[model samples]
Structure formats: structure tokens, C-alpha cells
Target: MKTHERMPELLAPAGSREKLVTAIHYGADAVYLGGANWSLRAKAGNFDRAGLRDAVTYAHQHGVKVYVTVNIFAHNRDLNGLESYLLFLRDAGADALIVADPGILLLCKETVPDMPLHLSTQANVTNKASVRFWQAQGVSRINLARELGLEELRTIRQAAPGIGLEVFVHGALCISYSGRCLLSSYMTGRNANQGDCAHPCRYSYSLLEEKRPGQYFPVEEDERGTYIFNSRDLCLLFRLPELAAAGIDSVKIEGRMKSVGYVGAAVRLYRAALDYVKERREAGAAWEEIVLPPAFADEIAKVGTRGQTENFFSSAPSSLAMLYDRMREIQPCTPVGIVRGSNPLLLETRNVLEAGDQLEYLGRRLEPETCTVRAMSAADGVPLQRANPGSLILLTVDPPLADGAEVNALFRKQHDRQAE
Candidate 1:
């Protein structure tokens, strides 16, 4: 792969401090995030002044690159304060700034001329001339719009030989044109232009004619109506060969307001996949067995993903599950007791117990689950609390459970956001 003259980068999103670390540790070649202002995900937990500095330092320590977002459509009022923000980004250690507004791009180049300017996908860069224009204006990269077909990108690459091209390989998609819709403002007076989108497109709607006041018609699916105006999530994990051969520079994932688990799982999977292709080129063959395993990505799917679909790369994907709700939280069962000694496992139970209740620890690693509780014993040498929710339970594990490991005799209600 080294001789293949290709070093495709696996770029991931890092919305929080912990997420950035997770990306680097799990394996992201680079990361992108939004700062306080001028970012598409203004509602996301963007970095404060101190966090950006820390994030840059941590990523570089692990040899990962960082890109900050300056990509929101800016207003005249927004234009006045960007210089200080640019200076802060420059000194705080940003490798590049992804910009959508032409004026913002120009200002970024003029102010932080040393930093690499990446044209945002919002620029709708579908032609060679625009690519060349941005390149001349000092853009080191162009995040091509998702609306373009792969062949269109090939033509753009051939025409603008000098400009580097980046495209989103995975994550959410909008029903609008290249993700630049004004429907939110038109519907709810929430300005998407100023970044307070109401996401009216995601809502299910019914149409009614003026002649028929009470009669309504379903838009797409008649049953309960559909996820109309809802597009599927994009995934290109299996299409690595085509993407690598496409002559693009970086393959980016689009999720900034997502969780750390999501960032780690998806980034690790793609990072492994990217390395798989890289290794194939280096070793001159595919091991097939050694390439990225679906099991890895599956573990991430358990962390609440929209499920994977290969959206519109080679062909359109089937329907995707809706994005996970960040607010609908998953709470852990409170730890009540810990294993104290090694007899029939001398243990202290939080709640009252009989004798035999299936013991469980917060086992996370290994098969069948190490923390998964199965066996049980009693501190009094009598075991019988076989079925219970809260009890000072002593459950024996296949492999002796850790002494300090948390034991659960209680079951808490778990709900999937969409399922609920």
C-alpha cells in the first residue's frame, strides 16, 4: 500500500473532549469539530476556548490531525467578529478550518493564511472551476457535496488536478439540495441561515386540498404516512476499493452532535477498514480473514446507531432507522453491593436476598459476557434466591467474577429511544 502511492485518511467527528480522545485512541487519522461560532452544529456541544486548545494538543500527541468548522452561512453581523475567532483557532492549534461562506473563506485565508482552508460541502462544489477558484483562494481541500455522483467527482478531480477533494463516506443525509435548505425558516420562522433549524422536513405531514377541508392525503405511505422527506444514512464501509481508487484525498464521516460511543465504534470500524485497504496495497493481497470484521461494527450498533446502509455510492441504501436521540438517556443500574471474599463467595448484598439469585457483574469484555451474571451462592452457605430483582446476591460466574466487580440483583427498565 505504501508503494500504491495512496495514504487515504480516515476522518471522524469529535464533538466533545472525551469523543476526540476516543477517536484518536480507537483510530482516526484526523478529526473535525465545531467551535463556539460559525459552525453548522451550533446546537451541538461545541468546544469552548479552553477545550479547543486541549483537543488540538491531545490529537497531535497521538499523531491525529484536527479540523475546526467555520462552515455556517454567515451574516453581515457575523462577519465583524470572525478575525478574533480565527486568531484563537490559529494559536489554539487547528490544522485547518472548513469554511462554507465565500467571504468567510477569504477572511480565513487572509487572517490565518498559514492554516489550511478546506471548502465546506455547503459551497456545493460540483464543478472544476469552483474547485480551482477555491484552490486559488488558498483552499487546501474541498469537501465535495454529497449530491454529486462518484463519476461527477472523477471528472472534477481530472479537471482540477491540483485541488485535493474530500467527500462524506458515512452518516446522516438531508432531503434538501446539498444540505442547504431554507424550509425551516419558511415553515417555523426558525432561520437555518442563522443556524436555528426546526427540521420541519423530518416531521411527518399530511396534505389537504382547499376544496376538501376535512379530507387529507398521505404524502408517501398511506398507512401512518411515512418518514417522507427522510433520507437514509450513508455508509461506504464495504466500498473501500472503489473509494480508494477514486483518487480522492480524504473520506469523512458526518456526525458532530453524536455520542462518544458512536464516534469510537464507527471510527474504529472505518479506521480498521481504511487500514485493511492500505494493508492490501502494501502486502499485495487481501487476507479476507484479517480485514475489518462486521462484529466490530456490530458492537457499535448496540451503542444505538441508525443501523448501516450503503446509501447512493454504488446504489441507494434501503430505509435507515432515525438518528438516536441524545437526550433520551441510558441510565446504569446503581451498584448496590460488591463481592467481599472467596468462599461460596463471601459477598454483601444491597437488597435482602434468599440464597440463590442469578449473580451478575457489570461484565463488558469477552464472550458470553464476563460481567454477565449467571451463577450464584449464599453467604450463609445456603443458596435459593434464584429469581429476584434487588437482593444482596452472590452469583458465581463461569470465570470467577472480580471481587470488586459490581453485582446486580436488580433490573432497571431499559428503553430504546425509537422503540419507546
Candidate 2:
């Protein structure tokens, strides 16, 4: 690696033990996961106590660090067992605790003094002063808010060069400042800050003025009203050099609730991008020559997403950052199968897989490989023309694969399948 090409750690989301393993196996340097409690992603398949221990052990065995989230804004009742939870995480050998609440931070300091603390993005850290203050309170790292621009980030880095700073280089972007929003709670009675976001921001709404009780008008003058608060998904794979130049210590990829395939593909894509930048820097090439590979964008698109946008990274974000017309992810395919065996490759189907259907196999630390399904048979050796969901079938593959490879269908953009 070149002297100036120190690659910031690529931190991926590990929502469960499976995700944790997938992230590490796919080349994530570190992973951040939420516990069953005190996490912002309540809908995610979060790890419990036993699962947390197993996850930590798995990541450590793979030479990856684990950061557990204790970042929820707590009410009086929520703080009851927080101290014990903190100690449990410490004993579980968690590398760090991602926290947002000052009270939680204080409690962590009082309870587990040796536990490393990472300030979560929910803390809305937007300046060096806040960074220094947190550092004084024993925060070793700060995940900066998404509302900051590159220029603001550069200034913060210049002011506090010694303090470690992380930024969200990819994944979902919150419309509110640092994700402090009342829309979810106000609309659905679920507090977003407490890990139960209803995602009211993604819902379409119309205008209902006073004295217009029976009338509804489109907010954006369209027939379908508008998804006013829907923010576009963030993508910064092409801007790794700028982030490194801005002195970012780590680059985080969000989406703990996403699929295992998403986690695997994303980790590989960002890992490749980081390696590409480091290789170019080591070659002593001009920064102008560093261009993001077109394939990188295509690979990212393979996973379901609403759309991509820079989202305040370049300049003041306008209407361009929000996707008004669509709300759900536009996935191009259905996850048909997952590899259960390497030798004489076996597949466990999530969706129906038919003979002669072209499939894409996604694996850890490797690019996706496309192959045609020539023949299929049940695990019992019965010849089959099609394998339904929950059926395990053996595939005749030209190149044998290692265990745990994921197989997905290559459906077109207009083709949409119900969630399996």
C-alpha cells in the first residue's frame, strides 16, 4: 500500500449471525450489528445474547471486528437493564459499542470502563467541537451524520486529525437531520429512534386542507400524489478517493435489514473498489486517472434498491435526492436458490428453479458467475424438471462451487415476484 493510500476499514451491516458470517466471508474488514434490544433496526433479524456471542466468535475467527449497537434513544423504562447489557457485550468480546445517547455513554463509562465506544450517526455529529467533546467522554470513533458535505467533512478532519471518523459511503439516506424524525411516531405510533420505524416517509400522501373534508388533492400535481419524504439510496463507490482525502477513518455500508445476497454483493463491490484505489495509488498514478469501473455500478444495481443518489455529498441536495414516484425497491430478480453443497453442487430453493433457466451464482470474495441450469435432480436422486421452493435439488455445474454460494434468477425489470 502507498503511504497516502491507507484504506479505511470497510464496515458492513451484520443484522444476524448469518449476515455477520456473510459480511466477513465477503471481505468486510468489520461489521456493525444491532442486538435484539436498544437498536435502531427493530425489524432486522437482530442477534440475541447467545447469538451475539456466536457472532462475535465467528467474526473474530475470521479476523473481523464486531461492533454492537446500543444506540437507541432510551426512555426511563428502556434503561432498566442497559448496564447489564453493556457488561454482557463486554464479556462477549465485542470490539466496540455504537451509542448515540449521552446517558447511555455515561452509563457505559460507569459500568464497563474498558469497553470501546463508537458514537453512532444518530448523534448528529456535524462539527469538530462535538467530536472533541465526545472524545473527552471516551468516544474513540464518530460515525458522522449524512447531512454533511465533503467540504464540511474536510474541515472537521483538519480540526481533529487524531480523532477517528467514519462516514456512510453507501446505503439508505434519512430525510431528517441525522435521522431524528417524528414522522414515523406521529403517523404510525412507532418511534423511529427507538428501532420501530414504520417508514411513513416512504408512503404517498395527499393534501387535505381545512374545510376540504371530502376532498383530496395531489401534493405534487400528479395523479398519484407524492412521496415527499422519500430519499434516494446513497452510492459513493466512485468517490472513495475523495473520502480518503477527507480523512475518513472508515466507510460504512448500511442495510442491516437487507438480504444476505445484498450483504455479500455489497461487501465485495466496496472491497474491490477500495483495492482498486489502493493499487492505483501504489502505482504512483495521477488521481485524475482513477475512474470507477462500470461493472462496480452494475453489480450494486443487481441488489434491490429504490434508486441511487449522492445525497448532500456534492452540494445542497434538492428534489433530485428524493424518489417521489416509487416507494419499494426495484429488484431485477428473485432469489431462487442457495448452495448447500460444493461437491456435486446441491441447491436449496427459495423460489421455483426450472431446468434451462439461466442463474447467477454469488459467492464470497468472488464476482458473480452466470451459468445455465442444464439438469436438476432431487436430493434423493429423482430426476426433476422443476424444483419448488423449500425443495433441495442437485445441479450439474461445469465448474464445481464451494459451499454457501447463493443462486438468484435474472428476471427483467418489468418482472416482479412476490417475496419468498
Candidate 3:
């Protein structure tokens, strides 16, 4: 099938149960998460056995698919409970298991013979041979390494037309070659492959001359210290046409460790973009002639990032791919609270929200209504000028909204002024 003829899945990351729900509400066709033990994102509130079951149930109920992460590179001791975990995932009704290690693949085949398998990017399936190799091993999908260019992806797709091809369309760019770096383990004794990465690559590095004791030199000519290895976050919203044409089956977002607000905003933006692309494609529009919505240009900025780059997608990456300073977030808005109830609009505050503040309700349908924080007070009905983070607050809504909506405070990053 032609790439535009088939709509690719929008796979979002969900680190926790709440995030999973948020992703689904924001229009994620599928969500990828890790179980507590086998996930690479050890710090990301990964689902326990019960949590995994609940998450799967919730996602499936919403008609969204869930893929469990079992991609950790296992050692001898790690394989002890591997079978049991696979069984748990099978019982949990996960749509697939993201696997990297060859041992894990065999174990999944033996233990949960019916479960689908997706080869993680850690496998670095760059060429058609690797794709075919994984396909022989029963991997239903192969997440192409982040380093692959459009031409490379097209080649792989042409070579292995039957297998599902997934690629990271957005999120943080790894400094390593498909996340095979040893810098984290070598620096902090936290193995990246084992799910305990300390992210030492984002740290600034200084040259230490062996001959000149105690003398440290900056790696880059930046007075504010250079983060030589810290890469800019990937943003390929404009390149969706290229990716869809490259025969990618799924467009994956790369932040399982990100916040709930970020998940919702990012997923919604991508969802809208994909819908637009599909519409244009159906209208017989050429890839170069398709125009994205103007609002989407700045919409992604609401999700905090360390800057943005196209990475290796456009061409060979140079210094343009690296961020020589600290990871800067270009956030123009902040999450105010989450709606617990609609009547009187009870909210669990994530940031200070004042009366008359403009609040955007993030929900499954992407409601266009921007609510004003009229007559705000504590949940107990105590009048308040503003509700701080962690407070259970209430806001008067003109037209009452549905229950379980997420609220975000609107502001501009430059002026720090309230968004009118």
C-alpha cells in the first residue's frame, strides 16, 4: 500500500497509569510503557503487576492498544523471573512486548507464544538484513534506530514490506548510537541497557589534561560551559510527510519519563497533525504541497523541551544537532490542575491558578473551549485569590465541562504574562 493510503499509528509513551490515560484521551492510538522490573525507564513510575493489568484494561476499554516494555538486557540472574513476567504480560492482555535481547525473544516465544513482539530500537535494526533477521525471530515490528535517514528507512521498508516499521518521530535524541552508549554506566555505574541510566550524556564535559594536574578546559568555546554531548530534542512535525512516505507503520514519541501535561499536549498536537496530513493526502495533495496548520507551529512549544532539531532526518548532522548549553525549556504555558469533578469544577492543582486566569481543558475530544477561572476557591468553598500546587481547588465554569478534564494555565514564556 502507498504510505499515505494507510494511516500510521501514533504511539505515545506512558510512564504511569495516569499518563496512560492522558495519552489515550489525547488521541494516542497506542501507548508503550514498561513494567516495574523489565522497563528501561526505571525512574518512570513503571507499572507493577496490578498497575499493568489495570492499565491494559483501561487502554483496551478506550480502544487503544498497550505495548509492554520487556527490553532490558538481561543477565543470568535477571532471567530468573523472566518467564513469570512474560506470563503476567500475557495475562494482562498487552498488545505486544518490546524486546531487545535475543534471550528475551526466545523466552517470549516459549512462554507467551501468542503475544506479539516489537524489536526495540536498542536492537539497532538499520539494514534490511537486520530487519529480516528480526522478522525470522517473530518480531512483528522493528523500531528503526534513530540514526537512520529517510533513504535508509525507505530502503528497509522496500526490502521488508510485510513487517511493521516503527520510528521515533519526536522527543529527546539519544547521544549514543541507538542507545548503546556506555557513558552512563562508566560514569555513574548505572547501566543504560539494564534500565538504570543516569543520563550522563546530558552533563557538561570538561577536558582534563593528564600532564597539567587540576587544570580543566571546556570542550567547546562557550563561556557558559558547553554541553558537548547534549543533543536537542527531535521535532519532526513538518516532516510527517517524509516519514509517512518512508513507509513507517508507527510514529513513536520518545518521552515515557515526561509529565502528564506534556503527554497530553504532545499527543494532541501530533494527532491533529496526522489528521491534517491524512486529509491532504486523501485530497491528492503532493507531499511538498501539503501545508500544516499555523497554530501547530507554536503548539509544540507548550511542552517543555531542551530545544528542537530535525536531527539526522534532513541530512548529515553537525554541531546543529547538539545543544551546547543547558537543556532549555521553551514553555509558554503551565499545567494548572487536573479536573476531578465537573460540577463547580474541582481540580487538583499542579501550579498556582488564580481567579480569572485563562484555563484550557484538555480532554479526549480536544475541546476548543478555553475556560476562565471565574470565582476560584479551595475545594472546601473557602474563597481564594489563587490555588497553589497540590491544593484541591474549585473554579466556576460558565458551561460546565465533563468530569476528568486536565486544566492548563496559559502564559507566554517571554513576557511571562497571562495569556489573554
- Each prediction's RMSD over C-alphas, in Å, is 7.7, 3.0, 3.3
Clashes of each: 17, 0, 0
lDDT of 2 by residue, 260-337 (tens): 767766787888888888788788766667887777777777654777888878898888778897685557766676
Give the alpha carbon lDDT tens digit for every residue of 1-420 in model 3: 245378789999999888887788778999999987888899898988888899999999989999999998889988988898899889889999999999999999999999999999999888999999999999999999988888888999999999999999889888999998789899899999999999887887789999999998987777777787888888888888888877789999988998877777788888988888888888888777877777778666666478788887868788877788765554667777666765556777777777767766665443345666668787777899877788887778545555544533211112144442
Q: What lDDT, from 0 to 1, does candidate 3 have?
A: 0.82
Local lDDT at 402 for model 1: 52
List per-prediction Cα lDDT, in the order shown.
Answer: 0.68, 0.82, 0.82
90, model 3: CA deviation in Å?
0.7
List, residue by residue over 1-420, the lDDT tens digit for candidate 1. 445478568888988876787677667889999888788887778899898999999899989999999888988988978999999999988999989998898888788889999888888887788888878888889998786766777788889878778988887776676789898888998776565677676676777999999997876555645455665467766666666677889999877877554565567567766776777767766424334456555443443334455655554444443422221224222223434444554445544333322333422221112343445555444555452433444555445655444321112112223433
Put the candidates in lDDT order, highest first: 2, 3, 1
TM-score for each of the candidates: 0.74, 0.92, 0.91
Q: Please list all clashing residue pairs in model 3, or write none if there are none.
A: none
